[model samples]
Target: MDRRFNKHEKLKSKKLINKLFTEGQTVSAYPLRLVYLPTSLNEANTPVKTGVSVSKRYFKKAVQRIRIKRLMREAYRLNKSTYFNNLTTPHAFMILYIGNKKPTYLQMEQAMNKLFNKFINATHKATSDEKNT
Candidate 1:
């Protein structure tokens, strides 16, 4: 696995971000909530475009928020290949840090793994159901 979150994989479009919040489905694992929307992207080969967000309302300081975002991104970078590489279509994902306190890297990673597993099961189950019908 490449184990890198490169430029093209970063979800930076303002219009897509807005649409995701309105139309996306979520899978939450305590401190982290992943909001994902199935969408077509210009990068046809990348299966997922991802963004990480730390709420200023919870962290209050820019430094704290930045740290959280970094941690979230690191966690996602490490876990992305195992959980996301096999998807058949492109999707946009925004991972939100919903916890109030600062988190250690291990905690962030564990939560990320759980969050991704939940999302995979949800999406795969829905797809299998569609095929069955």
Candidate 2:
């Protein structure tokens, strides 16, 4: 199983993030803002790069921030394989935690999974509708 989501593949550039926020489709599942754009990487067989951000104000202590980020990352790593398998095109994904307080790993993981499932279903429906039309 491919388990690495490299930095270069990640939507890390600030400019891209800004553009996506401004123009990309958005779905809010509380704590998670899923911003996605339909695009592809040049590399052959590359999984879409994803980034996760937690608000600093919500997590004042570095330890809390790190813990949340780690939980988010692990959840994404485990659940993202299903997303990759189902997606027909390459896309950029951003998982933004927009909560006002730190959450436990289990809480964050559940939220992330819910957000991801919604995104995948919506995207797939959109793609299928477009193809049918």
Judging by lDDT against the true structure, name the best candidate: 1
RMSD of each: 0.9, 2.0
lDDT of each: 0.93, 0.77
> 87 in model 2: Cα distance from truth in Å?
1.4
**Model 2 bad stretches (over 4 Å):** none
lDDT of 2 by residue, 2-69 (tens): 66666666677677678777778987888878888876566557657678887777688888777777
Error of 1 at 31 (Å): 0.3
> Where is model 1 more than 4 Å wrong at Cα?
none
What's each prediction's TM-score? 0.96, 0.85
lDDT of 1 by residue, 1-133 (tens): 3798999999999999999999999999999999999999998778999999988888898999999899999999989999987888899999999999999999999999999999999999999999999
At residue 27, candidate 1 shows an lDDT of 93
CA lDDT, candidate 2, residue 78: 77
* Prediction 2 global C-alpha lDDT: 0.77
